[model samples]
Target: MVQKIGAQYLAKRFADQLMASPEPREEPEEVVRETTEVSGDLDGQIFHDEEGQPIGRAYLVRQVEVYVVSPTRAGAREELVRCLNEPDSRVYLREVDGRLSGVVYTPDPARTGERTGAMRADDV
Candidate 1:
């Protein structure tokens, strides 16, 4: 017999895996605040952080594969973008069947900028 897991269980499992992973090296504060524009399919308005600093405006680039685990590929892509826009959420990417899939977890509601209407790339 097979067992089915709820979304909450899956979420917790993903979070636990993330907690067990290595930490990423931190970048200097100035570098993180630099502003740059993203063009093409992923287009949207820009917004600032609580300190009036521009958000999502860094020039230093790194490749990231965002995955949203859903029943449909389209749903996964949509969820990925939604999670990316959340200021306080930590996104975790994992490889499944040779493709990268991601799970977003928000550990702190206080840090979440949901009320501020942070920058978003919904059109992507």
Candidate 2:
């Protein structure tokens, strides 16, 4: 689904940013976890709280985890996730491999019941 792909992309981007920061002198492996935190209703609606308003439509992008082996990893992860999801983050959606990618408000793609988990670039 578009939302699933979007969340994965966002999580990856956030993970990458943390790895590239100067706080981490050594490179750290990116750990991306994509899970359906919430599913849409029959009508394809997702509800979220926006300041006091109830936003009824929008694909929710969340960070399940973004961390490094260093002590500053948790703080770095928190800052990066907050920055990416903030109003000024300027994050947008993109399409890759025929599926919608990145974080943006949009409709989800239909599920085709296929999965390719953790395929490395060399495997392609």
Q: Note the Cα lDDT for every prediction shown.
A: 0.55, 0.51
- How much is the lDDT of residue 102 in candidate 2? 48
TM-score on alpha carbons, each prediction: 0.26, 0.25
Per-residue lDDT tens digits for candidate 2, residues 1-124, read 9999999999999999888757736655886766554443423465557665766766544432223211254565554555555554333456668665444421112221243358788998
**Measured by TM-score, how close is model 1 to the native structure?**
0.26
In model 1, how large is the Cα lDDT of residue 104? 41
Worst 10 residues of 2 by lDDT: 104-113
In model 2, the runs with Cα more than 4 Å from the true position are 1-53, 57-73, 84-87, 104-124
User: Which tens-of-lDDT digit does each residue in 37-64 have in candidate 1?
Assistant: 5443234445578998878743422333
